[model samples]
Target: MGKFIDLTAADGFVFPAYVAEPAGKPKAAVVVLQEIFGVNSHIQQVTDRFAAQGYLAVAPATFHRVKPGVDMGYDEAGMKEGIALKAAVNGLPAPGVLTDIQAAIDHAAKASGGKVGIIGFCWGGFLAWRAACLLKGLSAAVPYYGGGMTAPAEIALQPKCPVLAHFSDRDH
Candidate 1:
């Protein structure tokens, strides 16, 4: 249900994204942000699910700038590696991975000709929250277990779009 496409950011950085299109006309578009493990199979499946539900879904490889083709499993080693990668992205200059998300949102809105929304998990959730606050062309945001997003600074930033945050009671 999905395929890879290259999107160029405002900084002329091109990255790959997993895109899933619905069978008929789409009601809207959704940007599915990947977890810390990058846009792996699970993320692609989520995008496909969104496409199945009549939305054009795009999951960008947010880790591409730091490490391309990351597809780590849910193991201790993977967690450590993913954490390191996320930290690297965090240490990047201002507007690091956010630009990639903006590119995906812009593509989704243009391709589907409708409003765009974002949803993410884990580290991606934090990025999604930032996108809602800093990016353009987003109508709504949903961050599931957004790590590091509850800080006072992050919470104080006004979001440009409405946001729905889902947190697990047992989250680390």
Candidate 2:
């Protein structure tokens, strides 16, 4: 089973995060941002994959701020619920979700011996891109099918570090 840890954000809020470590020295620390679903099995599997690739991996439950312990599957109903939760949190002003993302990156760095990267899926994908912009120590960022990122002018500029974004035509 993957390891679980409690991470405290900058604002003194606590959240659950899944972590996976490689056998040898890590090439870098990777913070895995979850899909609309919380840090569920799929996200954990992805974290494990990063660990297998020689990176220390951590996937933070971003929605833990609004509602803790919200892990959901990839079903239609799950999608609706996840979307609702996303809307509630995403609608917040600047420095809201960014606060959580920064905290995740810092926590992973401390746990993984410093160097850090980020990756995100679906809604988390947008967060990944934004994290690259907001966080200072990021080495790289990968965002996949990040919905609703196209219109955010502030987060649309070139990232502070290297970033690779994957988008599906059907998602937009």
Candidate 3:
């Protein structure tokens, strides 16, 4: 239902992305951002689910710059390692990953004929919001449990598209 593909960023950085195509003609395209764990099996499943819903889906490996092919479990050690990796990537320059995200969005728009949306979880959730604000040509955004997106300054970056955000009361 899905396969891995390559995408080039604005900076000419090439990275891998997981793509799931709908069985029939697509109604839209969705750019699925991954958690801090990278484009793992769970993310792939999500992409497949979106594809099953009649949308072309893609999930770019946002951690490629710092650590390529990162797929970890949801155990405590995985969380610690994922947090560390997230911190490491966070230390890099602004919008580096965003460029790759834009590449994904561009692919999605082309695939769906300009009707594109983005959805993400955890760290990817924050990125989904950021992508909404920073990237162009998005029709909508759905961010689930974006932990670090509560900052006023960050939220001030208005989205170019409609956003549907989901949060857990226990999430910080």
Candidate 4:
């Protein structure tokens, strides 16, 4: 089973991250980013899956900057709340939630003592893409149907590491 732990960012902001350690030694670490929702159960399960694959996994709570303890469902009400929360985070000054993701990556690398990568879905995917381009200490990045990733500005940004993006025809 995985448990929640605290990770401090470069700016001294602390946040909760769901971490799952492998049974044996970890081959690497994978930082899992949440969807539009917060670090909910599904994201935690993804972290567990990574651990099962012999990787250290960490999923940070991306919404903690605006609101603490945000766990919502997939219903319309949840979607509505998530969007508003995302906007609030986006509205924050530069390097808002990105700092939190960096913290997760930093922790994963140290705790696992190996290379680090990142994966994300939906809104998290967009962040993952940006992280690949802007963050440090990542070996690779995968963004599953990253929202707004195809925008002119986002597409123009060069990635610091290799990136594998997954998108469906419905994203357009």
- Choose 1 or 2, whichever is better by lDDT: 1
- lDDT tens digits, residue span 43-161, model 1: 99999999999999999999999998899887888889999999999999988999899999999999999999999998888888999999999999999999889899998999999
Write the residue-wise lDDT of candidate 3 on 65-88 in tens digits: 888889988888878888998888
Candidate 2, 1-172: lDDT as tens digits: 4688888878887878898998888888999999888989889999998899888898888887778888898889888999899988887776777787887788778878868989998889988988877777798999998876687695557789998989897652
lDDT of 2 at 129: 85
**TM-score versus the correct structure, for each prediction:** 0.97, 0.92, 0.96, 0.97
For residue 97, what is the lDDT in candidate 4?
93
Model 3 worst lDDT window (10 residues): 163-172
- The candidates, ranked best first by lDDT, are 4, 1, 3, 2
**RMSD of each candidate?**
1.0, 1.8, 1.3, 1.3
lDDT of 4 by residue, 1-172 (tens): 7999999999999889999999999999999999878988889899999999999999999999999888888888889999999999989998999999999999999999999999999899999999999999999999999889999999899999999999976632
Q: Report every candidate's CA lDDT.
A: 0.93, 0.85, 0.91, 0.93
What total of clashing residue pairs does each candidate reach? Answer: 0, 0, 0, 0
Clashes of 2: 0
Off by over 4 Å in 2: 152-156
Error of 1 at 90 (Å): 0.5
Query: Among these predicted structures, which one has the highest lDDT?
Result: 4
Clashing pairs in 3: none
